[model samples]
Target: MCNGQRTEPCNVFPKNQYIEVGSSTEVVCQTTCVRGRVFWTLDNSPIDESLSRTINSSHTVLTLRNFTHHSATLQCHSADTQQVLGGTTIRTYSKPSKISCMLESENQHGGVPEWVKCNWEHQIISPLKINYTLIYEMPLKPKTELCHSQETNCSNKSSSGPIYMFTNATFTVRAKTTAWETSSDPYEIDPYSMYKIIPPKVKVTVLPDRLSVKWSRSGTYRICHCEVKYSKVVSDGTPEVVLKKTLGANESIGSATIENVESCTNYKISVRCAIDKAPWSNWSQEQMVLTKLNKRHVRLRLWRKIAAPEESEMRKVHAMWKEIPSTCQDTFTYTIKTTPYKDDVPGVNYTDISCDNSTCDFDVSHHAHRISLKAFQKGILLAEDSVYVPATGKSLPQVTGIQASPLGDVILVSWKAPVQPVSGYMIDWTHNGHQYYWKESKYTNTTLSGLLDKKRYNITVTPLFEDKTGRGTQAIHICSRVGDPGNVTITVDPNDKSVFVSWDTKSQEECSGTVINYTVFYGTQTGPMLNVTVDGTRQGIHLKDLSPDTQYRVYVKATSLTGTNRSSERLFKTKRFDPRLLLALSVCGSIIIILVLSLGLFCAIKWKKFSEKPVPNPGLSSVALWTSPSHQKGKGSFQPFDNPSESLFDQIYTEATQKTSTSPLATSYNSNPAGGQTEEYTEAATVVAPEEQNEKPVGQRLCSPGESTALLSSEKGKHSPYRSQSSVESPTSMSNKLCKRVPVKQLEKSTPVTVYVTLDMFEQGQSR
Candidate 1:
C-alpha cells in the first residue's frame, strides 16, 4: 500500500550551476527511488526520455550541443512515478563565437564559392541537435545568400570548415544555428592588399665646384641605399649627365667634386634613397644647386715723370689688375700708354717710350718709341716713383756781441752785424707765444724797450730770400736781460769835525779825471757869514773853531775837462751845543744888573731928602749931676752929642735892608765882599758894652784938646787917632766917607770902560 505521508525530495543536479554559450556544459538528475527510468526536457518540453533514465540509476548526464540563447531552460526527471523525484532546469544566454573562413589564395576577388564549409562549437555540455546554415555577403552590395547544408554539404565531414570563397569580389562569412537561436560574429575574406611607400626626405648643399647630399628615413623604414646625380644643360635643351654615384645604406651623407669649372657658371644636382634594396624612389623633385668659380688673378702698376730744364729729366710708371680668368694660364699683360712733351710741343729727345717685362720697368730714354704699353694676365706688378734727393753744402754766419743802454724810458740795443751780408735776415721770436713774429729784414740791430721785467722770450735768426725761402740753416739764438739796476746812489765821508757828501755820476758816459772843490758857508746872526773850500775831489770842507749848534748850507759840483756839473746847494744843521751856552747867560746877567742898580739909586736919593731933618726928643731925665764950676769950664760944659745909639741903630738898619735887596750889584758884592771896600765914622754919645768897647780900635775916636773932664776927655782922645780906624763898615757909610775924604775941588772925569758884542746869522735855500 502507498504511504500517505510526504518524504524529502532529492536535488536535481544542482540546477546546472555554471554555464557558458560557446563552451560545453553538463546537467545531472538524482532520484529518491532506485532503479527507475528518467527523462530530460528543455523549457518543459521533452528532450529524451532514455537519457533521463540514466539519471535515475545515478548515471544521468544531459548536454546541449552548440547551445545558444534559444536553449536557455533544460530539465531531467524520472519516468516511472508521476510524482516529481529529482530533475534539473537550465537558463540559457547568447554569446558571440568566432565565425571563421580559410583563404584559398592571396589574389582572389569577387563572390564566395557555393560549397564553402562552416562549423560551430557549443558552450553547453549536451550535444546540440540543432541545424546550422551558412550565409555569404559580397563587397559593395546589401544582398545575402543562405547555402543549404544538404545541397552544398557545408556541414559535411569531408569539407574544410569555413573556407573563404570569392570568385571576383571580396566577401564576408557568417553562420546561424537553429536550436541554439543565435548568430556568430562576421569575418572578412580577402585575397590581395596594398600599402603606401614614400621616398626618404633629402637635403643637398653646393660649394665652389662640389656638392653634398644628406637624407632621413621615415614610415618604419631604414635607409638601405643612397645616390646623387648631377648634369649640365646643353644648348639643345637636354641635360648632359656629369656625375652619378651610389653609396652604402649606412652612409646617409656624401659629397662629390666637379673640377675645371668656368668662372661664374651654374650647375644642377639631384639625390635619391632606397630601403632594404627596394627600387630607387623617383628622383626627389629634381632639386637643383649652383657652384661659384675662383677669382684670384689680379695686378697693379704706377708711373711718374719730371720736366725741369736745369735738373735731370726722368719718368716712372706702375700698373696692376685683378679678377683674371683661370683659363688664361700665361703671365698677365698690362699696358701703360704715355705721350710726354715739353713747352706744348712733342720734342724729339723726350718722346721715347720702352718697357722691360722681367722688371716691370718702362723707360723712355732710347728716344725711339713714342708710347709705352704693358699687360699682365696673372701675378702682381713691381714698379714705383723715384724718391726726392736733397742737395748738399750750405753754411751760416755766427753772431758776436750785444749791448743795451738805459735812456729814460727807452732801451737802445746794438749788436755786431755779420761780416758777410746775406740776402735777408729773419728774426724768429716769441714772447709768451702770444706776441710772436718771424720778422724778415736787412738790419742786424734792433731796440725792444717798454717791456715789463721777468718775462721770458726765445729768439732765432735765419738768413732768408725775397721769396720767403729759408737758407735751411740757423744763424744764432739770443735773449734779452729781464731786469736791470736803477740809476741813483749816495755816499758820505767823515772828515775832522765835518761830514763830506758825494752822489753817483749822472752822465751817460763814465766820469772824466777833473773834479771841482766844494764850499761850506755858514753863520748865526742875520748876515754874519763865513766860507770854507774843500780839497781837490772832496765834496765838503770844515770851518775852523765854528760855534756848535749852528745850522750850515752845503752844495757839491763835479768839474771835469768839459765843464762844471754843480748840484743845487742844500742845508743841514750841526749837532746841538754842550755847556758852551753859559757865555750867553753871562752877558744877559750884566745887562739885567745895570738896569736894577739905576732903579735902586733913584729910590735912595728920594729917601735921603725925606729923612734930612733932625728928629727932636721931648722927655728929659729926672736927676742931674753938677760938676765944680772950675771942672765944668775945663770940660767945655760936656754938651751931649746926638744920640750915638740912634746913629748905630741907623747903620744896622741900612745893612739889613741891603742884604735883602734884589739889586744885582748888592747880590754880587754880598757874594764877593773882599773885591771892594771902604770905611766911615760919625760923632755920637753912647753907652757901650765892655766887649764892644774892647773890639773898637784906639784911634777910631775923635777928642777936643781943651776938654779935660772924664766923659768929654775920652771922646776927644778917640777923635785924635781917626787915621788908624778899622775899615769894616756899612756900604752907605763907606760911600759917604770916600766922598768926603776926596776934595770936591780935586775930582776929575775918568774914561768909560770899552765893551764889544757880536751876532751871527744863517740863510737856507731849498734845492730842486
Candidate 2:
C-alpha cells in the first residue's frame, strides 16, 4: 500500500464449482488495488513463480484455466507485501446434465409414399429441468403443437423417453431448461416438417380441329414442364400414336400437325404437368375431337331421252346428290312420274325421286319425268308434260305455173298442180274478193282471163283431200290480165248552136257479143260521167253545140259481152275573140305617144331660146362671149356710179343695157328705129347685123352701138327673159307713138331701142 491510494476488497470464489457431466458452466474473479501488484494463488501459494500478478490501472485480474470436481483452494494477495486479500476453499461434484435445445426435435420426418423421422436431444445439470415444444402443420389441416415440461411430469429419473409421434406438417421444435427454478439458454430446432406435395391439377380440352391443355399448382409452385399424348382410332378398333410432345414450363399448350386426315375422324388426347421441384401430376382426362366433313357436296344430275313416236314424245330427267356419308341413309329412296307429251320433250331425261339414307334413284322414262331427285334427301317435282301429238299435215302442195285468157263474159284460170302429187289441187280466183270462183286443175298450168280493167283479183292454189281441206300451201293471189279497149276514131261536126261527136270501136275477143251501147261523158275537166248515151250498135252520134271559147273533155266507152271499155279522151277547144290582146296593144300605143310628146316639147323650148338670141359680132362678140371681157367692162363702168341714186340708176340701166345690147335687134335698131317697128324690117335687120359684123376684120372693133346693143339684148334673153322682153316691148310702143314728137336727128343720134324677143310655141299634132 502507498499514501493517497485506495484499496477495494477482492471477490472470492470457490476454486471448483459443481457442474453436470454433459453441461457447461462459468467462473469469475474480481479485484481492486492501488498502485500495486495483485495475483491469485492456489492454496496460499503463488499460482506462477515469476510475476504471477502484474500492476494494473486500479484493478486486478485472476485466471484459472482448469477446474475439476476435486476440492481445491484459491487465494488472492498482494505480491510485494505478502498479505492475503481473499481466499476460498470448496469441494467439487460432477453430475450428468440434461441437454436441451431451442428445438424440441433435431430430426424431422414426413414423406410422400415413404415414412419420415424426426428426433431431438438436450444436456442439463442435475438440478435443472428441461421443457420441449413441438409445432407442425399438415397438408389438409392447420398447424398445432404439444408442450412438455419437467415440472409437468417429464422424468429425469429415466433417460427422457423417446417422444415419438406424427408431427404436424409444418413442424417447428424448440427446448429450454431451468435449474432449481432458474432458466437455462434456449435452443431452436430446424424446421423439418414433411409433406406430400401434389404437383397440380391439369385440365384438357379438345377442339374440332385442335387440342388444348392447361394446369396450375399450389403454394408458389410453377409448372416447369409438360407432356402430351394423342391417339387416332382406325376402322379396326385399334388406336395408334398420332402425336407426342414434351414442353418446358414456359409453354402451356402444345400443338401437333396432322394433315390430310379423313373427314369426321375422331382423336383422343391427354396431358400431364410437372412442377418445379415436384413430381409430375397424373394425366388429365381424355378428350375427343372430330374433323368436319367437306362442304362442297351438293350437285345436280341430268339425263334426256331421244327416240320416240309422233304420238309419244321425248322425255327429260333431273337428279341431285350430296357427297357426305352421314347424310346418306338406307331409308332414302326416290321415284318419278310424268305427264303426256306430244312433240319436243325436255332436254334432261331423269325424273324426280325420293331421298333416303344417303342414296336415291330416279326413273326418267316412266310416263314423263316430273320431279327433281336429291341424293340422301326428298326430291321436289317442279314440272311435268302430258302425252300429245304434234299437229300433222304440215306438207303443202306446190304451184308450178299460172295463166290467164279471155272467154265470153268470163275469165278462164288454170294452174299447174304439184308434180310430187298431192291429194288434189284447188284453184280459186277473186275480183277484189267481191266475186270469186273455184275450179279443179288437173294440168300443170292454167289460164284466167275476161277480167275487167282497173280491177284486182286474188288467185290461190291449195291442196285438197277427202279428210279435210289441207292447209293452203304455196298460194299466190294475183290480178288477171285485162284486154285493151279498142282504138277509137272520133269525128266532130259544128252546127249553128250544137256540135256532133262520134267514135268507132275495135273488135275484142273477150267481149260476149257485139257492142250494145255507147256512153259519152263530157265536161270541162275529165271526171265522172255527167251525161250518158245509150245507142245500140251505132258507130256515130252527135253532141249539141257548146258556147264558144269553152273547153270540153269527152270520153266514150264501148259496151261488150264482158264489160265496157273506155276510149281515150278527146279535149276540144272553141274559137272566139280575145279582148286581152287588144287591150295590151292600146296600152302600148298610148305610152309611146306620151313619151314622144314630152321629147318634142323639150326640144321646142330649147329651140325658142336659141332663136331669140342675136348672133354677136363674130370678132368682138366672140371675144366677149368666149372670155369674161364683158364682166370687166361692166364692173369698171358701174364703179363710177357709187352714189345710192346713181347705184339704183346704174342697176336699172345696166340691166336694160345688158338686155338691149345682147339682142338681135340691138344692132338693127342702131340701123333704123323706123324699121324695127316692122316685123319684116326687124327680121331683116337682125339678119343683116351678123352679115355686116362678119365682114369686119378679126382684130378690128365693130360699130360700138350695134355691138353693145346686140351684147346687151343677148345677155338679157339668156339671164332674164321677162325683163328683156319688157324693155324690148316698151321701146317698140314708144317708137311707134313718139315718132312724130321726136326729131329724126335726135332719134337717130340717141341710142336706138332694141327689141329682144324669145319665141316659144307649143303644137299638138298626131304623127302616126
Candidate 3:
C-alpha cells in the first residue's frame, strides 16, 4: 500500500493535471531500464489492470475512466519486485455559477452604501482551494476589483470607498484555481434599487381617542416611505387586528396617528421603511403600549388566592393584578374594597385596604368575598373594577394527554380537550419558587418561551369554563437537561407471576438527545438478576413468569443519544393469591351461608308445626269454655237438660233426625245459616237408629236431665246403635239449669273422649 505518501520515481509522465468532474484522463508510466514493467494504483487502491496497456517493454499507458472523485493520487509500481516507482496528483474542478450581489446600508440617514457582498453557487465542491474576486463597475467609473478572498463569498467592506446610491452598477465574480479559471455572468442593478433600509426605532404615546406613533427616519433619502403597524394585544390565542398608517417623508422623526383605538388596552406596535421603489425593511422589535382610557372606566382581569382559614376562622386573601399603564398626569394609588358575602349576597359593611402596588394582602371572614379595586388620583377615582370570589371554586373536568416538548428556543405544551364545556385554558409556569408567568389560550396547546437553560420548571395547565376555572395538571420540565431520568414505579401481579414496570422518560426537548431504548432489570432476593429490553416508545412493560410470594428489586434504564440513565432501585413483594379470586370466593361463601341459614329456619318452623298436636278452634267447637273444671262436678258428672225439647243439642238432633228420617244411611248433621252443610259438626254429633231408640227403657233414659250426655261416637267415620251412657247422679235440682252437651270425637280409638256441657239456661234462670 502506498499509505498516501510520495515514493521514489519510476519516470511517470504527465505528473499533475486538473480535470472537470466526471471526465476521464490518461497518464504514461516509463523507465529507462530495458524490459521494465509497472502497475498503477489510485488513492492507494489498485486500479483495474484492463484500464492500462503496454506501449512497449519499458513503457505503459494508464487510462482513468469516468473519474468522479474530487481529488486523488495515482501511483505506479514495479510489477516483478512490487516496488513503488512514481505517483501523480489529479483533481476535479467546477466553475462557480449563479453569482449575485447586494448592497447593504444601515444608516438611518442613508445616501451612500456601506458595503457590498457578492456570492456564487457551486453545484460540486472541489478539494483544491479556489480564489474569488468581486469585480464591479460604478455608474461613471471604470471596472475595478472590489474585493478578493479564497472563499465562495467576497465583500467590499468600503474597500473602494463609499459607493454613490441611486446609480446603476455592475457586479461579477471570478473564480480561479492553480490550473483553471472562470467568471460568472455579469449582474447589473442600480445601487438604490438593491439597497436594504434599516428598520426605524419606534415610540408610542397614548391619546384620548388615538395612538400617536413616532419613528426616526430610516434613510437620508427624502422620497422614503415608512409604515407604522399597530394591533391590540390579547392573551387568548386570538389573532390581532392590525392597523397600518403611513408616515410623512422628509422629517427627522416621522409620525403617524392611529384614530379610534380602544380605551385602556395594550397594543403591540412596530415600524418598517423603504426608499423609493426598494423593498421594505424588516419590522422593528415589537413594543407594548397602552391606549388612554376614559376617566372612571377601567377593565381589569382580577384573580385572588385565599389561604386556609386560621383557628379564628379568618382567611388571608392575597389579591393581585397586572400593573396598569397610567396615562393620567396625577399620581395614583390603588384602593382595595372588600365586602363579605352572605350566601353570595354582598354585605352592607365594606372593608377597605390601603395599597400602593399591584398586590394587596388582608384578612377576611369565612365567607365569599366581593372585592373591588379602584385607582385614585388626588382623591379622585380614575378607574374601578370588581371581582366576585366564592369560598370554593366550582369543580370542572381536567385536560388529558398532556405533553411538553421543546421547539427551538421555546417549549410547547399540548393537551387533549376536557370532557366539560370549556371556553379556554390557562397555562402557568414557574422556575424555582419565584414569580410565575401565565398565559391564556383558546387552543389545546401553547408555547412557553424565555426559559432558563438547565433549570427545572413546573408547568401547570388549568381548564377554564364560562363561570369557573378547573383544576390544573402539573408537569415538571427542564429546558436543558442536566442529568438522566431517575423515576420508576413497579407493581406486582401474583396470580400471573408477573410484575408491571413503568418509568418516566424525558422528552427529546428536555434531554440532550433522543432516547432510543429502555431496559427493565429485576431479580428475586436471592436469585440471579434478569432483564427485559424494549424500545424507547414503550413507557411500561410487563415482566411475566416471576416467582410468587417473593421479594424482588427492580429498576429501569434508558438509552438515548446523549447517554444512558438508570433509575433508582425499588423493592416490592409478589402477592400470595389472586385478589380477584379471593374476592369472588368471599362473596360466594357469604351467599351460601345466608342461603343455608334461611333454609334451616324454614325447616325448623315447618317441623314444629308438624310435630305439635292440632288444637281445635274454640269458635267452632266451644270445647275450651265447656271443658273447664268449673263447669264439671266430677268425671262424667255433667248432666243433660231435664226437658229434651228445650235443650239446644236436643233441638238440633230433633231437627236433623226429622230431615234425615227418610234416608236411613244419612251421615250428615249440620246447622248452617248459608244453607250449606258445615263439616265442623261432623265429629260433634251422632245419629241414633230407630231400633236403638225403641230399645231405650221408658222411665230410664240414657241421659236424664241430671245425668251426663255424650253425643259423639269413639270411632271416626263409624256409627253405633249403643247410646253414650252417663251413670253419674246429680242430686241437686238441675232441672232449672238450661245446659247443653257438645260432643267431641277422639283423635284415636284408644284415646278417651270428653263431654263438655254449657250452662246457658243456668245463667238465664239466675237473671230472672
| TM, every model | 0.17, 0.22, 0.42
Using lDDT as the measure, the top candidate is 3
What is candidate 1's CA lDDT for residue 106?
A: 21
Candidate 2 lDDT over 1-768, as tens digits, reads: 222234564555544354333343333344453335666676655666342333345444454444553545766666677666666664333322233221222222212222223334343334334455544444565544443454422312112232223442333445444422222222222222222233334455444344455554332222345555666655655555534444554564444454444445566656554444344445666766665443232232222222233344323222222324452232323333343343335564433444442223323343322343333333332222121112233354455555555444345555556555565665656565434455555555455545565344666666554432433433343334444456566766544334577787764433223466788777766444467677756776666645667677777877665467777778776546444566798999999999999999999999999988653332332111111233435642211211222111111122122212334533322344554442221111121112122232211122223333454565553332123222332343333321111111112233333322332211123121
How are the candidates ranked when ordered by lDDT, highest leading?
Answer: 3, 2, 1
Flag regions of model 3 displaced more than 4 Å. Answer: 1-10, 19-26, 31-40, 44-68, 76-85, 93-98, 104-108, 112-115, 120-132, 137-142, 150-169, 175-193, 197-205, 208-210, 214-297, 300-768
Candidate 2: worst-modelled 10 consecutive residues by lDDT: 737-746
> Comparing candidate 1 with candidate 2, which one achieves the higher TM-score?
2
Give each model's clash number: 63, 93, 4
**Model 1 ranges with Cα > 4 A deviation:** 1-197, 219-223, 237-239, 242-260, 295-768
Residue lDDT tens for model 1, 168-287: 233232323433355555655442211112344657666554556565543222334555566653364545554555555456444555555444445565665444433454465565
Whole-model Cα lDDT per candidate?
0.40, 0.43, 0.64
Measured with C-alpha atoms, the lDDT of residue 130 in candidate 2 is 48
Best by TM-score: 3
For candidate 3, report its TM-score: 0.42
The whole-model C-alpha lDDT of candidate 2 against the native structure comes to 0.43
